[model samples]
Target: MSYDDLMAMRPGVTFDARGEAQVLVWAPKAEKLQLQFGEEAKMLDMEPKDYGFWTLQTRALWPGDRYRFLLDGKGPYPDPATLYQPEGVHGPSEAFDLQEYEWSDRNWKNPSMKDYIIYELHTGTFTEEGTFAAVEAKLDHLVELGVNAIELMPVSQFAGDRNWGYDGVFPYSTQNSYGGPAMLQQLVDACHEKGIAVILDMVYNHLGPEGNTLGHFGHYFTDKYHTPWGDAINFDDAWSDAVRHYFVQNALMWFRDFHIDALRLDAVHAIKDFSPVHILQEIRQQVDALVRETGREHYLIVEMDLNDTRFVKPIEAGGYGMHAQWVDEFHHALRVSSGQERNGYYVDFDGVASLGKSFRDAYVFDGLYSDHRKRKFGIKADGIPGQQFIVFSQNHDHIGNRMLGERTSQLVSFEMQKLLAGTVFVSPFVPLLFMGEEWAEPNPFQYFVSHTEEELAEAVRKGRKSEFAAFHLEGEAPDPMAVSTFENSKLQWALIDQPPHGTMLQYYRQWIVLRKSQQLLRECDRNGLSVEVFGEKELLCIQRVWGRQHLVAFLNFSKSSQEVSLPFEHLSWHKLMASSDSAWNGPLEMPEQAEAGALTVAAESITVYANIINS
Candidate 1:
């Protein structure tokens, strides 16, 4: 059957106008299938259909009813497309009704991609409660910080109570530990009401090892290729069309039912597909159609290690046509330049020069050789807009994957932390901040999981130690199965009112306000930006222009104060913002303009100047 015909089959529970619900299962290997509702309910034999599908229609199934599929009359298993896993991954799936919630965001519209100031947070560690309702309670803090969008780490149902959510077995279920499907919908609805967009991170490359039953249902996995997690998803092998439809529908469900504004596709590079039409392209096409039908903007942001522009390039240009992608080069360059430990991937990057190149070109290794990979990597992202690339100084992978889970704040001084903020916020690309980055939260974002299987937990612990050994990191890595590890990662929200933390928080607020108010600072076009490096003096001069307004930012990465020449010596410049201002408790002395012929910038400081000369 064609792809469209297989997708039209709807291989899950669907309800009609008269409240009659239909339960469908796709088990090609099984000769008989039955639907078992509740513990004492009757077992109904599903009528077999074409293309390995079995269906059973009844008026008995209603919202909140628990059911399991009995394949070949052997035993029961949770639905592969389960909407809610209230009893955990091993138990029966709970039926959920999306239409029951009374949403108050009817007139809410998502902000355009260019205007996005993304704040990425893990729902579990973002607050003390670690639930969807708890995250909703903290929305006011994000709004006050001037962030228009919040990107959540994966929330799919995983093994136990605490996990990174990347090892989720059920793609459709909202984690039962995090208040289930209704709570997730409530969080999204609340965000829209506050003029904030919600972005969900999704894993489509491979499912987690535990609680996965798709292989028994159909040819959902293929042995042709292997992923780091497990067998590759069947996107091109026999009976792969149905598998593709399953994932595609999952992506649509987040937008259609939960009202998510965008989806951050996790590690698109691992998705192995050799078909005529790539899966990413197909997702983009469907998402575009959904946007047209709903009259609301939706985006697909990818997290890829390969610095290829094909993911975000236009479809007509022989690309997948994704909206944006996370650019790690910016983070790597910033980390190394700020005197962080150089190991593993950090070996390839040169300090300030590489950072300057990223400021100008958006990619440091654009079609260049890499000492770490032993091969040339990435394509030139010259003409692409800056909004298509999301950049950050710290993220989950950078901090959580470390042996000690130390944040950038722990690695650098308070003045340097403010400098990091200035550099990230002033850049042309869309900036993303980790949960506690703004206030320099002292908690480490360690890797933690709650795997039920003892053997699997030991394997994860061994894998983590071996992985960090390659980076030459000494000491033992934190135990991933411990509850303390997850608790230690939670943000200390009360610290925001403390002395230096409050000062830093206010600095971030001012920087974001400045970014929004300035036209040249918000320009996404690379042609309008330039970066000049003074390597010997550890200084960088970045200038961005939009029409008549020009913004020049001078950053000093040295330990001692440096006297640097302004980018525009002749034009009159006004001080826009400075990281070393006394208001932020820095040691530097702020001046109105250049003294003599150069501007005297304090050690590890950033100062921005603006000039509006119509020429």
Candidate 2:
């Protein structure tokens, strides 16, 4: 499709078939607007259109041309909707044709949500090269691990060479340090070729402080509703239609231009919009239309702190109609149950019972009193399917936000790590794994940023230290601006060839394969699951039944071995997998069959049993 047809002919730089370029920009504050093209510094006056949009037709622009907008005889600035910022965020934007690059996976279809085993990773830290090309080199490893989707952390252009990607300034442009837009397109194409979907995480709640020129051009943000990062985006105020369209168009461009299969919105709880049609709902509706037009399966996942099912509920039922959301209660419950140091939000969850509760019900804080917030938190998610909530034992925020940036491997024993993996993979909800989590890479996923401005860099360092003060952690917090910090976070890929790492990798592969093969394990029915906890013995039992198909898991959270009575004594069961099995290089041997009696579970181990007769 043509650029105009793909982007709905929005206001931006567009080239016509007659070899003329059309420049359209929204700059209501500028009484006069001029476009500077090429090395000759050729300037052209643009005519003012309705709704503060300026348009001009000129032969001075081409497909590979460079241009900038001059407002009221002022200095030149990059286009707000620039698709390619080859240089850093402050440099001039490059004009490029989206149709230049070719795609091979034209018939690529996204896997269903129930089959999504998302692997979340940062492009800068995932590989030694820290580029999109480098990530493509490792697609074979993800395919071997059996994850269907790869959820990339934010890749939008930030201020400098290094960042967590949450501090993006230009939402449309891919990070220049990570090989820019063309490289990102290549990565997406590679993922689809391997039958894997690419889910890009985006930050729309607030823009980064540095290199942000949106306010200079228009009222893109509002001081009325404040976010933790800064002022929230203007979504429900006067002249907010333009601000909302800017983001909505960005979302569409990712799918149409880059062919991204899914979008994982970062922290939608911070997005304060009280409009008649909420921004979340608006994006979903527009994306749904695009899915029909392109005949592709697209998903919208939001990272919302509030345990509100309204975000995932259908629009006909008065909700946002999103596909899924990142639910943290499972992580919190799992961490606490595994005997991690409790502080901050960890204080709210009870140990084994809470973990069992999270497995049965998606949220542990559903309409319950929260000691952390001193209020009744979360609404009841009774009818929501288990697949609508994405659960993980460890993620970027769960590990990187720690004072020392420790993974579950660093905090727990090897056996407990195996148990943690079993619990997450066997659960009904969609499971996500961090980049190096499969083989247990020892490197910590620390928060690191490289800012050119000294003042902004130091402010970030101080803020990092102060935020971790509540944990009362020992030693000093890592300096985020230091280059060594970023280097330390890189995954050691060679470790996978070693002893324990190789065994752990096989264990993860086994569990993921088991989840996909078993009918009861793959079922997304929330009401079909039951959880029984022996709080005194530190043992948790989960039974998932769909019709006559039964899959049961026994998890022993204690340090010592425990004997647990089988709840389903009437049925004959056969062992499917166990964390303590000899195949996993563990000392214990799994019994071939259990005949309705007491079973001894090893210390910090998880065992799965299936009914002998299938429905």
Candidate 3:
């Protein structure tokens, strides 16, 4: 194959016009390479090419045939670009063809980032079967919840069956335990049929430790730079061109093959690349090329800890062309406001005032001094739009990383949960929800892993314990390796039929409906909203005005009722919905106020009103 042909798609199993399977691999370090295929384990010598690439073709290879490459005759390792691993990550790589699956979502156009209400869920905990088909069966619940986009946690092939999906060795292959690529394709088709876009979470900074043998092939890792996981990927070192191409092809494969609408790049801050053209920009350029070719909108969303707006800015503006990035400041501020224990990163946030700043500025720590960091952190995002930041009250890291793995419902009052949901939905930025948060699922989303090696499992446990020693919580954290820990994390789907759980679901549904119905909320313009904090009363007031629609939301974080005076008494503000209303199963107590035009906000509740006079 020519260089142009190699650049077109990821190098993997492909059938030629003669119906023979051909494979290409890059192994510059290897003096010799061989391939073993089929149940008979037939070995074939790979022809060395000029560009440090090895190629081989065989008529015996079938769709389900398993193969592995022998590098320098040391050992046979799984193909790095394998499409399907029918067995676990350590097992032989199975041959797969993208042409095998008949996709029905040809006309699917991705929803705009501004219009996305993303619901992030782990497939294992999302349903009882823990398969992609199982998730597809539950699509109706997401559609009814008003989420136009579903961000799935990483589904790549990891070490074991029960994992959070972060310890994935095969980036291109779907988790075999989750029904592999075929079931995933069916799920994407089902999601599109229900008008919900799919966003896949991809980890590119480092591959998992176990069952990963990329270093055996070439210099895929660099000792020049370091990451929390281990050695960083070689993006700017010698023999780095093929390494870059490998990951870029991974990104393109997800979009072009699976029809994934967007990719949520996991922990981009750790991607140490000093090249003139960043890996992110190259990804953006290629994705744009794909969009032009297919006439489908695709997005690249990143999760970075820095308060840098360059990722979301356009490429021509000397910034990475990322459609959006996760903004964790909103979550921290909201959690602190609701009386969460101030420790770790939460020490920097100062309750209601921080929450208010997130509403108006979208980036709370934009060049502001952080007490926790003991220095000024974050670049000022002066003119960034609200849609560029994705905010959520609860996500996998928020709940699962906790020592006790307690959800927001477990940490705060039921009314506070409602208030949190209202604050997220009413905000100008996009809102994301963790699985089972709508019905206040009592199950804790504890982090769980099922690595086959006992030594690695013990190391993970010790590391987790040492990390949480600073928090100084009461009891010991749950055992991440235990089956009970994984089982306990599953969402109780039947809880929505119960009393308080069902009522909380209704309250969440109302907020979602209101957010979609009101143009003021959907505008996602930073200039359209104003936020005020009444520190003494632990109250926040968010005022939004768009065209003839004027809306005001009063959020009370205190344990007692607080009355906030209306900003403009001249405008007749009619009550739209109060989370403390009886219909939502709140106490429904009407607090007595001495002054007129004072809005009584219930304890740990959110109250919104519309200006009827403006209309």
Candidate 4:
């Protein structure tokens, strides 16, 4: 199929072969469908097409016009493929021309997977203004931090202005509260202009509960599969072709229309599909075609909790052909080593030993018995490259899902916080930083929502409480319905200039600079990497060699200084950056040189050394 044909696959306000836009709706359940235009609700009959598609080719709708669908003279509802829901999810859908945006990113090129230093942030809370334009204004902060990509959490249209955005019922429409599709266009354009790529998180496993009208139009969901949120999307059941096309086109929309560099598929393990060609593979096939046509690189990153290598492996290797995936094992192991309370999944890890194994093997539980699950979990990810996994110390889910929503910086010691940041930079994977983590912002990222229905609101409150009942953490889980919960999640941008916060910011910036400048550290080289764990001392050493160059990191996970060996070919090893150094307000004054064999690293700190010749 041509690019235009692929764009037209989505049944709503899509451009034709001649490049003129038209309204098309797919309401398989509706006997008759009509178009309701403007505030006057002027009704116009829509001719039903062959397989439940409704179209009104005669009545042309322009950008900025408000409209909705009337199924069989029933009350009006928002379009399933609405481009902009200016009046919220329950209200009328406004038309916004997706193709009209004059992009300035023509000269921009997507960065390589290995070069991706991603910073994940929610659009609603990244800034106090809580809009896409506000996020663009913070580009200078991100540019200074040296992250090449920004991963915005799901931005689909949700119930109200305040949400983490996962509750969005409309998949195509950009959240109106966050400046709609137009502002999102501007953010993408501005990000590319600054040499930054955008990775949009898309939730396709299940739609949100509020304003969920897809069932009224078509069989978009099925009862066969169950997800944590609700019923799984209809990907393999009867009338699954239209459902598959709807989502595949949605993925294409992000890449083709919005110029998104990568899509982080949220929780692909929950997507139950018994079809020969899985939904994810089909999306990849169409995206590959689009890439050939546009001559630009696009990526699909999956968040599969299963730790299945088949998702990231190539299609030729009997996999889903995904570019990369968020590997939570690294994060879990790192967190456990950093002294996070052994609760929930943390109970399964053995601290530094797990972290050490994760460095060697991509998955810590690769075909091993998982005590948390009481069963064998995760197949071996032996052949996968490190760049195929995205690792983070703290992400939205990690922080927000906590009982009191405490950030890693708040829970761990100050020294451990810096140590965690350094470890991520030195890891053999694409590193990610959650918003406000660099500066140790003390604000909590509690779960919050603005659902209008009181019953739904009460259910959310109960659900949040039930999730962390096992953790046994000392504080009451914040009310999910409270506006304060959302307000508290916003990043305190001004904290970057404060004393310890400012110092932490410098530590992160310098670590990133070091990683980017060094040849061996720039990307993962499993062939030339070695990890050693000292269980008694809680010390982990990682050695990386590329050709003739050699670098080593000594990570002390203990609360006290630990003696470590630094074997070197030369008589002496040059001391590199260290969190224990006085530059970061630590006890140790880093020397120009270090003894080749033995050294004592500071408590909860990460120190690096290079051979005298390489240094």
Candidate 5:
């Protein structure tokens, strides 16, 4: 069938023949569907579709048309596919001409995956204003923190102003609550200007329940596979070609249209497809082709539960060739050693052996049997360089999805926090810090959404409570609908003045300085990495060497004061880069001897000592 004929049967009005037009919606279910074009008002025909969709096509539709769909024929609803919502999430969706924005980052390209220090952040909680522009103010801080890129949480338009952004339904639209497309451009513009790159987290595995209107237009989802959220996206089922195209197009939009440096595909394990050419492989090939064509550094990162190195292996080498994946091994090992919390996956890693194994060999499980999973899980990453993995102490899911929305600080001592930070940032792997982690923001990053339908909102509130109940902390779960949920999640910028917060910030700055200044931490060769245990079950010593420079990372997991002798009998200690303590905390001091190689480290602390003598 011709494209025009196919468009006729679709529920909502899609693009015109020229692929250059604006769309209008007038759903009766919407209280109102009025169109506000920056300033002008165009009353929509709230015509109901036999398939339950309302749509309108206008020739005047061009890029930069700011408009909102009025629900109930009167209330304003952000466009499901709004390219830009200049106003925050509550405002109208604007028709954005992606071609108009001038990019000055010609030399900008994807940095080596193994050399990255990633910072994962949610737009809503990253700043008080919770807009793209607000984050622009913090670009320098991230750059100074030694992060190569900022991995933003999903930014696609979702149901409400305060969502985590994963439940987004409109894959093509920027979240209006976060200053939409134009604002996103400004953020990217500023990031490139500061020598920092942006990586967007995208969710294509499933769509949110409330605002997902794709069903009315096409079979975007199917029952062949089930995800925790709901029906899985139709990637191999009938009419799945269109569904696959939708996602592929969206992926290109972020890189080509929005000038995004990279995209972090969320939960690839949840995406089920039976096609001969896996959609992910197809995407990787396309992105690689784009890189060749444009000569811009572009990359596709995946968040895969499977420890298959195929994700990062080159496609020609019989692998997927994804640039990087988040390493849960790092998080599990460190959390097990530091927090001593043995719940869920943490059940497998409470032993010091796991921490040592993780430090020595990047993966704790490493193809071994997982008792909790009741199967042999995880593949060995010994040959893979650490930079291909994104390691972190805490992230949105680790904290926000928790029953109480507790951060790493809630579970571990302040000393351990420093140790954890050092472990991640100094390791050969790429590191990521969740928002507010730099200064330890007190706000909880919980699940929050704004739904226009009262019934949908109530249902969400109940589901959230039940979801957390499985952890046995349901009573402490914050109400999803409560205004306090959103309010409490806001970062209190004032915390920067506090003692631990201020100190931690300074500690991060020092760590970044050392990371940049030192050669050992920047080493990307897997063969150059090595580790040795100092104490059997209390402290661990890891040494990374590149060329002649050697960096010894000392980590003490125990609470009580304990000490251990260092390695390298032929060398002397040079200098201590950072410690968990400051002089103000209790006479914090560097190692006594300024010699080159061997030394002793304290308990509940992480120390970085260098060897000045050339090898």
Candidate 6:
């Protein structure tokens, strides 16, 4: 609408007098814009501003009010800030009242940082139906497995039927096929009823390739900085305040309107802001205030590669005050210790000492010289509590971005997989289990996307092929848009009852149970955490302690049995709680006695011993 023509229309109903909610949309390109709320349309008068933003006020949109925006006096346009897209990503917005739905977890509160066992799952592929109801049925399973929280991959509306959701275009609207806004509420409501918290993964670094209309409405993107995806967001440029507000507002809406427990920010290293007060700090302050007002504890977790402890430290101590950060160093160290090839980032992490250092301080580099970047990188995360770091063996990035999307199941032996899980879960950090890792689903978690534009689709296909050329594979890279790509990635639930799958599932369940029952292992303290290297650089002994709870973790990375000596007395007489051996599905048949203060740890096996007995 022409800027002046949009200002000539007036609303039929008074909003502020009736205490109804109001909204203003800016669209300088349209000839005219009007509100299409059911049969009676309201004309909006746009207020002229320096940045060409159109303004208007409206009465509160109650539940079941179907609405759309009319541009240039033509047809209707989906709201740029739509909350629900019932018909899919291409449909009109539906007014959803948050108070209509009854919540069953009114008194339920989330577990503290020190008491979280996270389960990461992708909603689209988590179940056969790929809907909220399907995932809701599995809540009891997570609670049974002792996971306190569920971290879902980005659920924002993207352009395709299948995606990793890093390319989301609509930040406010929930994905349509995944059952939209109401379905998400139901899912969270069910989780809370089962004493499980929900943490949503959100991306603010870049928008999707298509269906992104923020640029057409106002100044959203700036050329001040550049990201690998495209132009960076204008956090410090002209009209950047509004752009920043758009994101923070969206974040608060998720917590306030939808009752989300927390939000996991994706790739914070790519976010650019050079203002006096960083955008992250601003977001932290606002969220903190919201928590105080609502009388509920909400968290903001960020995924960063900078290895700076300030991201997780408190604001009072001159830090960004985020609840936690995904610690990639732990993943890299475990992967290299398991004999993984030096791929892109793995080049900096191929030593047993690196693994030891990560276990000791939670970061392998710790400000040391890096061979990959040819510069010193990463600071020591010594004083930071282990709970502030979310550690995992494998995530979507590690599996899907690989040349063929080979999971840990395809690369390492069954024993090694269990050994790696033992190493991670027994650490002081908050442990996370990737979807299907419990049962070792054999299918590759390959990267897949569907582009609506033909040229963009071709570009994505060609780019994917070229990206994997360095791997020197023999076959053609599968088309990401093909139905087989999505179908091949689905979890084979029936596999859990098979041979190796059954063994892996039992190992995970048993380890999780031990992690819960063992007092020393449950305490997330760095003071008593120590590691003893053995097996001529192939074996490791990890010890963790909190108060009266003391645990010794034995791991042998090689394929042959080895004897690892302990530093403490009575260690020789320790009992085994978990083993990765295929033949010996349970613990060792022998007594819990050691020979001459030494323990016999099987090759590619992991065993945990509790020093303090139960009352």
lDDT of each: 0.88, 0.87, 0.87, 0.88, 0.72, 0.77
On residues 234-317, what C-alpha lDDT tens digit does candidate 3 reach at each position? Answer: 988887878888888888888888989999999999999999999999999988998899888889999998998888899999
Cα lDDT of model 6 overall? 0.77
TM-score pick, better of 1 and 4: 1
Candidate 4 segments exceeding 4 Å error: 1-8, 15-20, 569-571, 612-615
Q: Measured by C-alpha RMSD in angstroms, how accurate is candidate 6?
A: 4.3
Model 5: worst 10 consecutive residues (lDDT sum): 4-13
lDDT of 5 by residue, 201-286 (tens): 99978888766665644577889999988889999997676566667767877887678998999999999987877788888887
Q: How many residue pairs clash in each candidate?
A: 0, 0, 0, 0, 33, 9
Tens-place lDDT per residue, model 6, 1-615, is 453443332211213435464555655456566667764755454444434444555564545666777766755766667777676556666766555567777897988877788899888888888778889988877776778889999988887778888878878888888988888989998998898989999998888886776676666788889998889987888878667767777788788767888899999999988887777888889888888998878889999979898788888888888998898888988898898887667888865667788888888887899988789998888789878888999999899878678899999987788888888888888898988998888888888887788898888898888887655555777788887887788888888789878877777777778667766667788888888776374877887767765677777788777766655663343565657443436434434644336667677777766665344
- RMSD to the true structure for each prediction, in A, is 1.4, 2.2, 2.1, 2.1, 5.2, 4.3
State how far residue 222 of model 2 sits from its true place (Å). Answer: 0.9
TM-score of each: 0.98, 0.97, 0.97, 0.97, 0.86, 0.91
What's the TM for model 2? 0.97
TM-score of 3: 0.97
Worst 10 residues of 3 by lDDT: 587-596
Model 2 residue 173 CA deviation in Å: 0.3
Structure candidate 3, residue pairs in collision? none
How do the residues 1-615 of candidate 2 rate in per-residue lDDT, one tens digit apiece? 333443355556766667677776768688898888788988888887666667787777887777888888886888887877777888888876666679999889888898889999999999999999999999999999999899999998888888999999888888998998889999999999998899999998988988888777778888889998888899988768778888898898899889998999999999989999999999999999999899988899999899898899999999999999998999999998899978988889998988988888889999999998899999888889888989999999999999878889899998999999899988989999999999988999999998889999999988998897777777788899888999999999999989899999999999889878887777777887888999988889988888777878999989988887655667888898889888887768879888777888898999988884444
Worst 10 residues of 6 by lDDT: 6-15
